[model samples]
Target: MKVLSDAGVNYIRIRLWVDPYNAAGQSYGGGIDDEATVLQIAKDAKKYGMKVLIGLHYSDFWADPATQIIPKQWKGLSDEDLNTEVYLYTKKLVNDFKQAGVTIDMAQLGNEITKGMLGVRMGNGDINVWKNEPYDTKLTNLLKSASQAFRESSKDTQLAVHIETPNMYNYDLIMNSLKTHCMDYDVLASSYYPFWGWGGNNPDNIANIEKMAKDKYGKKFVIAETGWPFTLQNSDGTPNNISYDPGHYQVGPQGQVDEMSAMYKAILSNDNGLGAFYWELAWIPVKAGWDNWQYNKLMGDVAGTGWASITSRGYYPDSKIMYEGKSASGGTSWDNNTLFDDQGHPLQLLMMYKGFLNGYESPANVTSSADIRVTKIFNNDNVNLVNPLKINDQLNVSDFLSDSGQEYLNGITGTKISDASLKAIFNDLQDRKQSKTYTDKDGNKYHYEFWLDGQTTAEKLNNFLKLNSGMKYGETLKVNYTATLVKDKEVPTVTSPVHVTLNKVYGLNNVTIDSPLTVGESMLAEDLANVQKAVNNVLTGAQGTTISGETFKNLQKAIPGVYNATGALEGIKVYTTDTGNHYIYEYWLTTDDIQGANKDVKFGDPINVTYSASLKWVKTA
Candidate 1:
């Protein structure tokens, strides 16, 4: 926690629940995450010279997007009564913290409030929508009451409305809610999980989200809680253990340093972003598994047996890294696709993970004992395909007799298919079994099908969208396909050339070159407008929609690229001008502070390109 404070994290968030322990007074889990625990944590943070941001869960344990059960104590309260209780509880809690000398820097009225902070409740004769509970009156009253309580309790403390977003698509809902609630939050709080960003970790998607949040919500925002596990003890190679707390308590850790490092880089590089807060610091690897800290350290409870050597400070101890090197399950198991034979020996599989720099190869120690193998052979690797049982044929969906297939004989509706159609479809499937193509009885042929190696749902959808418009049997769709085999692989580099041209000159002072000036945003605006006008002109003339795509592609090819030469890779942005010259070229180069270079570029500088007249330049701005 102090490390977090030293890293410029000013506020510490503590979630409060009405009752988080058992009836017999036994502690539940997540050590003192209850109200009393929260109070103490707040005081401790204050002692360390850090500010506190108290989060009121209003539930006994946890309340999130799925579970927002009202606290048992607040069960029978009417909405009106609930509003009053909230006000009083909030005020009392703030006052208690203040009196205890733990001044709150901010207060989150609720947590991840994409849905109503308090769930729907019954009133008068109908279910209360919160906004429409008492016919719109009580809803406003409830929000106003909560906001008023926070404001009146501490005038200097900022009120933050918290929401979780591991992706960009759900932000519209959050923005709409903030406006609906008329929330006067000083900062926007978000929870980010890169795994959730693109159904799996995707750095490009992460970049898109950073751009989206900063561009959409101009207010200061912080990654309220984001952490990745460091251990692999569950499915998908994640560490998820629920046994520690018997019934209600649960815990796990999976993507640790790699994920954390990525997020750290993102926050630091973001233009309108604050830092992040790793959730539940105590639950971190250093404090779990054993009672005696020394024993835990020795047995590797906090350090795990894997961390016996090394300083135990730089990311992980030597034991952890060495253990990972020896254990097959150490590194992410999701990357393992090497097939094994009946004898449990490794076989090269059709799918192979080609490391970024090295040639794809199976581990030297990996082996398979299976016999009677066939290889599908993806890319360079001639990996073996095998079934543990003696199976001569492929157990594909097509193998199930079409006549007896569930789709042909609809079990749900009991609809029957004609024999002729079944026979034709079966023949089609048999004919094209080698290729992935499928055809229906109607003789409609769907071309070009490829087996997708295991990928996230989001990746599958993106692949389908990029390659073809639709997916179904007997649907002829023109498509292009691009896919990556391994998880967390970087996208292939893409660089395209840009062409610049100059047309007629404008005035003496403000040189009106014929070339399109795709400079700042204003130039983009003018370019878009003129490009549409050119398209409209073409449509009104002889050229039809046949060449519209090509025309548009050419027109937009010369977009400006911003070069950040100082960075490892240059930052390139492309822009297009409207009606510029064709062959005649104009050159302009702009720069900003190139260290140790002769040229000193500042905010704005004039760079020009000169060309001769008699240029019959078509309207290309």
Candidate 2:
């Protein structure tokens, strides 16, 4: 609590499980964080002068994105009856906590609730797993009951609907479902651990998350629980020799601090963002309690011996790093600002072509002519054209005027009119002394095609040339073009085979392919088959404009592949036999220790899995 309060963290979330003891009447040890335990934590936290948020895990045991096991007491209850139980449980917990003199600033009816809690139901409760369903009757009843309980218990305590780390795409579904159900949640709470969720800091994804939360909830957003581990251990029960740098994600005190700083920075700036809460300080390493690796061994607060490292580490406060405030190191330096070209990417400026005009040499004869016209002038990036008369439209260049604009506009390669053809056309037009419209091979319309006088102003010539190049006939050129748009033509973008990797294992048989039409997105296997169906549903007969980011990411996740596990890491090591030394690194979560031990850890049981090393392979040949 002090660490958080010192770090500007005001609120703490403590989870509560209902009757964590089992049907067999076995009382799970370890406090089980039951109602009694939650109240105790709340009391302790308030004594420390910290705000408290009670996370009500309605189940007897753990609940998560994967499992929402029914509470032991509620197991025999019917679907309709379960809803009442949820409401009563929530109301009782809140009232009890209040009676205990603990002010509950906020309450989460469920924990990390990507899917709803108390998932099993009596009738129509089973979900079509293939569909990767939204809240069905069972989940709806549970949520509705919980929401009612929170609402009825205390109007002052804010209700937070906690979900998995914000995936801009899936978060929409959660918010939309809540809105559709009219579930009243005061704050949008999410759990974000970059290493496990959302992969890493993807700016596009981060921005999407901000937009989705602000747009959907229109309420304050808070990170309910988020933090990184400082130490990592291999599955083999050995300490990972690799150490983290202070400044990055490599794994160390500084890296954790940096990550926290970055996360806070991103969140506080979000208009709808409220604040964040650290998980638990009790889990911090201590000398006389559980083993160092019992929970968050990487945490210095838990590892009491390493208190100095954490206390001394500099944490750049929110007010200082955010809102344009600078650091003591002479303020921030923006050394990497750059301009993007037509494709909306950083442009690498380069001079590919340059043409100079020799001071006009008098034409010896009336017909001693050159195609004296400006053709194409490409920007340094070569992605954008810088001609004075360039077209401004989103359609393909071919859809615009002819003049071979199709070849020059829209990142297309430009072509120069052949010297012989230019001369012949110029002579014919000059003889006729007429201007006529012409349609180019690309089907663009050009009017008043041809050149005017050599003494014509550059502005007028530039305008005339814009259309003249596409005209069938117009004023003939008396002089040759001093600068013609020349290009060492290369084709536009070509599709490259997109490579996808799954951070976790998926069965080959469990995988299903969908959306055979859209080339960019295809779902492979082991994914909720419905996701593939969703991909196919959106992609089929849909134009490029209709394809969404969700559909695209789902397809990426669904790419069919099998992982080969070798060595004694209990299938945690995946290596492709063909690749000499390349392997996909993975860390798995197991319940064996937590389950085999003296406790029936409830749903939303906090567990930490750390990466020790990337699988290494050697050349056998």
The candidate maximizing lDDT is 2
Residues 245-296 of candidate 1 have per-residue lDDT tens digits of: 2211112211243454456566556676665565643332322322122222
Query: Which ten residues in a row are the worst by lDDT in model 1?
Result: 366-375
TM-score of 2: 0.43
- lDDT score, residue 494, model 1? 25
Q: lDDT scores for all predictions?
A: 0.42, 0.45
lDDT of 2 at 618: 27
| Segments of candidate 1 deviating more than 4 angstroms | 1-10, 22-27, 121-143, 167-169, 197-218, 233-255, 268-271, 284-621
- Give the poorly placed runs of model 2, Cα more than 4 Å off: 2-8, 23-31, 120-135, 197-204, 233-248, 284-621
